[model samples]
Target: MNFLNVDIPVKNVPELDKGFVPLGLFFKNYQKGAAKPLCIAVERSGGQIGTYETKIYGTPEMEQADAYYVDRLVKFLLWSWGGFKVSICGDDNVAAAIRAAYSEGGSRAFDKGFMEQVYETEFIVESLPYDKKPEAVQRAESIGRHLDGGRIGFDAGGSDRKVSAVLDGEPIYSEEVVWFPKTISNPDYHFEGIMAALSTAAAKILEKGGHVDAIGVSSAGVYIDNKCMVASLFLKVGKDEFDKKVKNIYTRAAEQLSSQLGYHIPVVVANDGDVSALAGAMGLGENGIMGIAMGTSEAVGYVDTEGNICGWLNELAFAPVDGQPDAMEDEWSGDIGCGVKYFSQDGVIKLAPRAGIELTGASPAEKLKEVQALMAADDARAKAVYESIGVYLGHTLGLYAMFYDIRHVQMMGRVMSGKGGDIIMETASRVMDEEYPDVAFRPEAPDEKTRRVGQSAAAASLPELK
Candidate 1:
């Protein structure tokens, strides 16, 4: 398939999404041209800066393509690495377009607003000369793996809430409670539910003759200092009530529980992505790992070569994947060809009808269950859906290689459940071997059964009690 000037020898293509072009393959072929220098830098909290300096096509005929290419790169960098101020050095036209798009009433208003809320700062776009460009901080701080004393680990999800009462490194009690947090608008529902979960876990810890030392929360969304900046669990909540109550709900719940327990219990809330990475790292005893969970959406995090988790957003759900101009659009971010549309249960639901499977489930998760049932029946159509995702992953890893120094890739979530997941991992490995010979997803996928901690339970190691 020819995308722009480059031709990609893609073997396994999605039947429905035939126009799919892997961004990694496309970029790899593009950079082999008369690429010019361009630097994209982003500054986040604590003035931490992350820079991606690369070559862009400088040919006069490729002006429009240059803009599209640069824009996607910046978008990927922002969501994956994260930043409030985007500094574009050595490109004026591309910078101008970004400034206009990120403006108050532009195409990327949603992304800009989300960043502002996350970093709690006004977002800015600046175009600078290469000489005046920022340098890479690449700050990967040591986090998680405290695993001491009495702790309550809570994982907040859109469908259910999971809490584990962990004493030392082992969990004394664990439970999963189903609730509809995404549909509820009242902050009290959230407050009461969180309190109930914490209270239940506390009772179990007390039964084990332990007292709450720390409360650690593993959750989705961008968190700044254990505060809810933006989360899907609070999607229905209004800004007024979110600020008034939901902002500090986790800590407040911990505080109230502490008041009852008669002890000062500090709570550390880390993004589930980071916790997943930490879990995978601990499980494998390796670093330079990137964790990707295909659940309701695509969640990702990285553990750098130094065995440290970076402070970046690692929100790959919104990061672009397919280079197809008319690729599938994500409902939340309203972005096309993103990971959420290709790597999550939504990807399965999108492919089901095309693969001749009629799904009648009301929710995305339930629809995924239907597909898994078909896969278990050795349905060829179900296999086709997973093969397409495998093709998507095999190519996207090349794109990810452009940024991260990856040694091992850890996969998780409901989308990766059952035999279908095996199809994805196996097919992806084959694609890597055939197409990206050098891009290695080494040591194979880690065994989930032997994992040190479940994705949510990993939060028990987040806080180091004082």
Candidate 2:
């Protein structure tokens, strides 16, 4: 049984005149003691192909020791296709480990930055038990569309829910309502809260004589085929009830709202992080953008050059960014040195008391707010928390570059509010310029109105309503 088999389509092949090449890697599981050699198949988009294989002499664990085989595979791909942009499809753990190796850099086979040139790579993992290929979906056309009448868009965050009435890509009315999805066990509470918010937004638009045309939603967690697979919002709901009812809660709510309104309005749902990236692209009018929302946890999304959302898990919160032996552990996932520990509100709150700045609030969010308020007053301890975050961002940007074709990074969320955000961005910029000058991209935080309204507007653009 070959461990790897890849096939590249002909249309993606780059011509000699083109500046870069596109490559694909299909990585299968590593069998413990299989005698079958590891194999890689490469072909021109024109159908010409050849097989490359190497024998494995040890257990799968031994083969993965120090990521030896992973390093060889990456080098082989780069050698086979020079200056190529690669997409990897494989097991989640293996892909995570390999990607971490590229940035964490402890391999002896290559120099520390040997893989820097081929940094714009993406990893797609099989989501299901029997999935043979990575997930890819054709994105809806044109994130910006003119709705002659009106549309309702909702962005559900961990702490609050934002609803807006949008027309012609501009939001006319918007409101943010606080809700406790994480702590509330009853799904009915969440359902009722969402419907109430949407109802309020829709009524405002209708009062202005503009009929509702469609509905769009942006939410946290893994959404596959418009169904919530794993989400923190449903954490309190039992597995049996969640799987049976809460999984497709968005669609159900949309249907109920449409029936109540006495019209069939099309509803489209997307990941909140993806919506954030779309919003950033719309705000900046640029492509190849990545959006990071450092709020309750680190949420991430990316938009490719063609402005299409890649349908992979872009859940960078759990993705490892630090490879040091003594990295900090994420209390939720128990994973060491993930993006969550460095780029989240929790990260700030965690460091606040440690920095000797006493927090007056009970919850993490409140504690973070207290620290931010202190930073506004030029408190040294609070300032240090943000400065450390800046350093973290600067170093992690280099690691993120290895996976994303990042040209513009838009930073948002509660953690990036007010004076604290400025400190973080300024320090991060200095770090990038001084330490990793080779990295060409810079991080920017959009204005408050743009960050808030633009996200809901982007949510409005998720569906293709004919």
Candidate 3:
């Protein structure tokens, strides 16, 4: 299929979605001939900057095509390597397009508002000079994996909370408790639950003649320096309450616990996606690992080659993968063929009908279960859905490789739970081998029984002791 008057080549097509065209492969061929150079850079918190140099079709007649290509690229780069202020060096028309699209009431309005909340600044896009293009400055910290003395590890989930007490890199006690953080508007419920979980874990450690030294949290959201920036866990919490009680909830909880314990317990909270990558890196005993968790939506984290978590926004859910205007649109982003639709439960549900499986009127989670159950029974339709996902992933990884220096990729979350998971892995590996053989890095999956060591040991290792 053509991408707005541009021909896109495809070596592998998803079993269910024939219109799938990976951005990575498209870029490789898109910049072939008569393309003009374009430089784009984005500046985020702490003056961190990410820059990309791309080429667009150069002609008055192809201005629309240039805008289309640049718009998607800027959006992808913004979500992949986040920034609130964007600088474009090249064509004015495309730069104006980027500015308008990321502004109020534009196509990326949700992204703009979210980034503004995350960075606490107005989102801006302007023109830049080619020779004066800013260099990339990333914030990558070697956090986590402390595993010394008494440590508390907490993973806050929408449906449940998990806590673990680790001593010298070994978990002494761990438990998962069910709760609803997303449905309840009362931040008190969340606060109480968080406190109870922390207290329970601390008690477990104290019973073993240990005390809390450092606490690390892994939760669904964006966090900077252990402060909650933006998250779905507080979706129902009122704006005023969230600003007053929730932004620093993790830090506040630790302070209260410190008062009761009669000693300061350092706490560090990282996005769950980053913690997942930390888990994968620690599991593989290597760096440059990207962890992709496919649950209700796609959550991604990256560990650079130096074994540090890059502070760039890895919220790849909104990032494009399919490059098809007609592909499935994300419910939240209203963008077509993004990663959230291709990599999450939405991807599974989208393919079921095409595979001749009817999951009418079922909850999304229940629909995933129905398909997984069918997979267990060796249903061909279910296999088709997974194979399609596999195809999507293999090429998508090719796109991911363009941005990340990935050495290993850890796939986790509920979507990767059943035999279908195996099919996805095998099929994706095959596609990667055939289509992206020269590309660096290989995808690896941890065992199903104990994938990434329950994330406790990893989260427990976040903060360094003084």
Candidate 4:
């Protein structure tokens, strides 16, 4: 459950081309009525531990007695390599019994051999399961049977909590749990909420005797390999801890869920847009295809040639775009992001003033509709706005192609709704064709079923796992 903090020295040896040091030895008896002793050695500072099993015979026979002598030899060698000072060897009851019998008996059977007390220290070790699976699943399923199928729900924009259980391909159970909230001081507030939702969902699945295949999370941030948190619209929970927490929860969730379901399986954690990409890519018959969801934000993910996940990736806002002098795409590009900045809701807001079109609410979809009607009358500003959105999307996709060798790009979300999507797709296609003459760029829309499946699949692929 917890790791020990130990200080150990590092040394280099020149003569024998090796380093030598002393180490502490601890022994434990795991099996009942055992004649031989199962032992383990731990460095004094506890940085490492080595385990070995040995059997000592009653008769001091050269061949058989020395046959099991490898144990002591191995421990000594390992301790020496670690640069520890071995003063005396300290062991538990079983180790003591074996040592005493060997010492007092002395001949072949009586002489179990020599075990010098290399170090004397009061340290202890205990036995624990490597992990618990299958059983946890059974327990979770038992709980599920008694429930009314309510699942825990989370508000993407707020903290409204509810429970809901939907059984599509797999049983997804969501629940509410306590979590530390993020504030202005912690800009990743929504990201924290996403993690909390995942944790509660994991717990619920475990409680209901169900196996969790993967968890897809929708957040206002970015995802990288090893589950690294690149940036967030809300919080600043450094990438180090973000990766650590996500991995830890993933392992715990998989083990517990598997145990409840009575099966051992791996679980994946992924960003929502990445999941969206995966689901969208399923329909595309290409080796490497990516899906980009351009909305209030942008999320990108790809499916490899074999259908394994690449990753749910983002943080392209900071990516540089061509033909933009002295400008970072996120800040200086005509839009906030080349593609998302121009095509998303934010893009809509910025373009309204230039086109002399005013939207009553902050909805990009509503604003776009208003802009479309104005443009239908051949308004130059309105048409330019939509055209620019398409051109930016095309340019961004062209850049992505260079990095991933991607073939088809599936577009989704409000950005892909109606006429704007068509224009964007046309622009993106033109850019891809111009840049990579040999490659093909196809665009398509994603349906609901594929979206759900893709989301879960992408989530299941989250990485930096133990």
RMSD of each: 1.7, 12.3, 1.5, 23.1
Clashes per candidate (backbone, < 3 Å): 0, 1, 4, 54
TM-score of each: 0.96, 0.72, 0.97, 0.48
Runs in model 3 deviating more than 4 A are 447-452
Per-residue accuracy of model 4 over 125-218 as CA lDDT, tens digit each: 2322223111111000000011122222222321232223333334365444444333333434434455455556656665766544433333
Candidates ranked, most accurate by lDDT first: 3, 1, 2, 4
What does candidate 1 score on TM?
A: 0.96
Question: Highest lDDT, which number?
Answer: 3
Which lDDT tens digits does candidate 3 get at residues 1-466?
5765667666789878887778877777777754577889999999899888888876877777677778878888988887899999877777788888888899989889988999999999998766777898877778676877999999998778999899888888889999999889999999999999999999989999987899999999988877888898999999899999999899999999999999999999988888888888777778888999999889998988999977888999989887776887777777887899989899999999999999964589999999999999999999999999999889989889988999888888899988988898888888898889988666668654336467766898998999
For candidate 1, write residues 22-128 as lDDT tens digits.
Answer: 88877777777745798899999887898887887767778777877788888898998777899999888889999998988887887898899888889999999
State the displacement of the C-alpha of residue 454, model 3, in Å, after optimal TM-score superposition: 2.4
Candidate 2: lDDT of 298? 90
How high a TM-score does candidate 4 get?
0.48
TM-score of 3: 0.97
Tell me which residue pairs clash in candidate 3.
144-461, 144-462, 145-461, 146-461
Give the CA lDDT, 0 to 100, for residue 80 in model 3: 87
**After best superposition, candidate 4 residue 57: deviation in angstroms?**
78
The TM-score-based order of candidates, best leading, equals 3, 1, 2, 4
